[model samples]
Target chain A: MTNKECQWGGEERGILIVLSGPSGVGKGTVCSALRSMSKDLVYSVSATTRLPREGEIDGVNYFFKTREQFLSMIDNEELLEWAEYVGNYYGTPKAFVEQTLASGKDIILEIEVQGALKVKEKFPEGVFIFLLPPSIDELQNRITNRGTESEETIRKRMTAAVEEISLSEHYDYIIVNDKVEAACNRIRSIMVAEHCKKERYLPKIKKWIEEVL
Target chain B: MTNKECQWGGEERGILIVLSGPSGVGKGTVCSALRSMSKDLVYSVSATTRLPREGEIDGVNYFFKTREQFLSMIDNEELLEWAEYVGNYYGTPKAFVEQTLASGKDIILEIEVQGALKVKEKFPEGVFIFLLPPSIDELQNRITNRGTESEETIRKRMTAAVEEISLSEHYDYIIVNDKVEAACNRIRSIMVAEHCKKERYLPKIKKWIEEVL
Candidate 1:
């Protein structure tokens, strides 16, 4: 048996899981529960050109950097996926994710549709899971209950959601967040199953077979 | 929400899970546990031309078949995969497995490596999971403990195991049968995760999107 605490067949590399869905789908709640559920699971902390807000630690909250450094990373192809959001470059740092996975920890990336698709281009084997609200009515209700958005803003979000769902087919799996705990469990199950995937154990298994023979 | 008793993303067609490994790798134990673990799971009863031994139930033990009927099934391509074993044709019934799946029940097929691979060629979408022992030595120990096997038979199986492990990379997932219960849980998790696969929901999701839009 390999040193992995998870009892998979071979020495398994940590899986990269990209989770994407529309707003008001309760992704945050389910991801938080997942973090508590598995100690081996890590949330990918993105690097940003924007300054960290109050009480935000450098690496823990976000890897805050100047515009020059952030742009430098993009030029070096160090970011898995990056985009300008409100004039600040926010992106998943490739090094951070690689280092975390190298340490035998599975990383879950909660990102938007574009970013998730971009990550797929970079890491084609990554598991892409799309989270969906139970129903459109429930999704609208959840958005409205937020009370922070104007009706116009809510309508804009709903429109965006429809477009987001249209792309859900590109994902490897779709998780309906009808219940928070159930959704978290489903993600965890996906993680475990991914570990058993043939791609992860190919090299090690080939070597093991030769040695055993 | 779909009629699936299991809460997956969409109405899932029952998946045909083909489980195969070396003879003494404890697939029987894991699969038996799985049958009890999920009531929705059904074991695929193979059709064999060999006469049913004393006290053997026709449909329950094996679909006891005459050589003529089995030959006709082969001609009609009714058997998904078949093999001539000791002058008797043993095979999986395509109709039975399809009907079981169409009725929204997962069917587990415990077959040899050749049969499993054959089934994969026929049903490319079926989940092919390779059950493996922790190591070659442990596998020998297991076969030895079986007392029913002669030393030569055990040695033959051990040699066969090396080839099987080499081919395990062809499987969708590999389950290490370290602990029976743990292996069972891994299979169950794989089943749940497979249900959430996007390919299973593509057509339904498109229709759902059109309706919602």
Candidate 2:
């Protein structure tokens, strides 16, 4: 409990850590590893118009929605960020993330680069982390190893990956996915370090210094 | 090692981490613990006109200097930050810190707040961390526990500590010294997280994307 006070000041809302990168850069794997490593982090499940895959439960894997419902959420500004890809709509529902953070629990959002950028527009305070492959060859190898894409689709993905990487300067931190465990550790470090930032805890610190002396 | 590129980009200078806070905030203890845990961080030895204490070695504990020698170093601007304390001149020698960082090894400098502010003027890129006691009463307790200071000296230290803590808003991060091991771990997290900062590696990442990809 002593360390808890030191971990973060009392009564502050938790941080939103946005994990994004080019497709196939292992964002999901790293985020899952990070969450497994630390119980303090809550994953922000997204909503999608796309049909659920086998065994994917609604609200657990994603908030499966109809296209009309997803569009309505977007129109009402109830979604933090949304994008259409390959003929299906995907978005982050704002209410759950807001409620979780207000309760002082940190949340991790693993999303596409475009969705991450949109979230940054609305929540500038969010910690935007850009994941990266060890190299282009490695990224290509990852996509190839998945064995789901055609040669033409692979080329398109590589080109899109390059474009996404170019926008990395817009992120707060970069984690190259050289190894899953190492990338996860770096993310944990980033989370701890963000908690220590003066901007987040200075008011509480100042109050403690001024009042309780 | 693959992780080396991920640790830091090629050929960039290492960071300088400045650890400073109030007089009795346990900055030194936490820093020493940090060094013991991390082999990569080199501790910076300061220069002083004050005579060396028992078992203190020249260039190890401090670069012991006469008033004349200290004044000359000040005249030549060889010291990064110098202050007169208890009628003695104390300073951080500029050369060693610069050389260590330039050679791509981080250096930790634990010093008074005044001296740290001076170092900030010279090395703006350095990571400035302010250590804090859990509370003012805790800080007073730490000073009292030292047993070397008289009542009047303790009062003076408490006043100075307050003034120093008020300036903490200028720091990049803050670590409350509730527990020494926890504080050390937080400092280590700051170091690791600083490497992940986009500002530190954006150019390298951009170049990699453009050229190597």
Model 1 per-residue lDDT tens digits across residues B90-154: 99999999998888778999987878999998999899999888766788798788788887887
DockQ for candidate 2, C-alpha atoms: 0.54
lDDT tens digits, residue span B1-213, model 2: 113555336336788999999887888788888899988889999999999899999999999999999999999999999999899999999999999988888899998898899999988889999988887678889888988789999888888787888889888988888888988888888888887788876777677766745
Query: Which candidate comes out best when scored by DockQ?
Result: 2
Show where candidate 2 strays beyond 4 Å: A1-3, A6-11, A52-54, A148-153, A209-213, B1-3, B6-11, B51-55, B148-155
lDDT of candidate 2 over A74-163, digit per residue (tens): 999999988888999888999989999998889999988988999999889999999888876898898788887889988888888888
Per-residue lDDT of B50 in model 2: 94
Model 2 Cα shift for residue B114 (angstroms): 1.5
- The deviation in Å at residue A29 for candidate 2 is 1.1
The estimated TM-scores of all candidates read: 0.92, 0.91
**Candidate 1 per-residue C-alpha lDDT over A60-152 given as tens digits, one digit per residue, 9 for 90 to 100:** 889999999998999999999999989888999999888877877789999988789999999988899998887778888988898888889
